[model samples]
Target: MPEPKEIGHQIKFPNTLMGLFKKGWWEIPEIMASSCLGLLGIGLGFIAVLNYVKNDGDNREYKKVYMIMRPDDPRVPRLKNPVYTQYKG
Candidate 1:
């Protein structure tokens, strides 16, 4: 994997956006277009995470046996029925 410095160094690229924009009027629209693409990526990533959480079923809790005893035991009647409850991922 890339080192932290190598990964984070790209943050400085945007620092030159203003300087690059001032270099020519034609570049303004290109810069805006590139920024829009970056925003689109961020929005898509957010939506994907939201959808994953909403549809995820494996992370939920479900009823399961916690104890067992002979069927003829008098305490069998006290055995509580297991139930399920909603779980948010």
Candidate 2:
């Protein structure tokens, strides 16, 4: 019987959106277009991530924060912060 083939690094390339957009994928026009789109996408993604991390979006308490302030609220919820609030979803 033939020996089973090795499964070494069968995946040769990244399949994610950003990963697929990496350099050397396109030939010319596609490369040109992707260059612009890819860079913008990367930049925007970075900004989004930065904004998320910067505003404590990953915090446990941040998720449970109230959307709207109640009358005579005693404390500030992370939801009170506009930038981080949108990232809840």
Candidate 3:
């Protein structure tokens, strides 16, 4: 290994690259590839989080079941509403 003073007063490369070289993160292309991939992942995660929060998250309006029928269809009998019975156990 060469002494720090032997190199020069200023580093030839960026600190990030130098630190990466020290950590051997550039052993293969995967780390470099992941750097780009990580940015993509961060973008996707941001979009997802934005969408969830945009609609007010868990407190957002939720649609319930509704009967779907056209005016052209034959008239149907009114369905009996199920009575809510209290459990007496």
Candidate 4:
């Protein structure tokens, strides 16, 4: 029977700075694609978070001010025996 060949070829690491640059040229496209995709993901995530904050944040702030300024307004529901008032200081 024929003997099995060695599992894999050895990767050659460059010893000099110029050799390193030359060896790494093949990986430039792969690196650039990964960087672009990462930036795109971050930008989309930022836009989503900003949109949520703008919409929800404005509504929350308006409700808070309305409740404070017009507690007796017909739109505001009246609470009997509020939780905060029940607590003895």
* Cα distance off (Å), candidate 1, residue 19: 19
Q: Compared with the true structure, what per-residue lDDT tens digits does model 4 show for residues 1-89?
A: 99988786756767898767655664586775687799999999999989988655344422334333255565334333222324478
lDDT of 1 by residue, 1-89 (tens): 97655553332224376766655444477877788899999999999889977765233234363544566777555445534455699
Q: How accurate locally is residue 60 in candidate 2, as Cα lDDT from 0 to 100?
A: 54
lDDT of 2 by residue, 41-66 (tens): 99999999999988777645456554
The lDDT of each candidate is 0.60, 0.63, 0.59, 0.61
**TM-score, candidate number 1:** 0.34
Q: What is the TM-score of each candidate against the true structure?
A: 0.34, 0.36, 0.34, 0.36
- Model 3 residue 47 CA deviation (Å) reads 0.7
After superposition, which runs of candidate 4 have C-alpha atoms over 4 Å from their true positions? 1-27, 57-89
Pairs in clash, predicted candidate 3: none
**lDDT, candidate 4, residue 69?**
28
Q: Candidate 3 lDDT, tens digit per residue, 60-81?
A: 1233764544535452222233
Model 3, residue 54: distance off in Å is 0.8
Write down the TM-score for model 2: 0.36
Sequence-dependent TM-score of model 3: 0.34
What is the alpha-carbon lDDT of model 4 when measured against the actual structure? 0.61
Candidate achieving the largest lDDT = 2
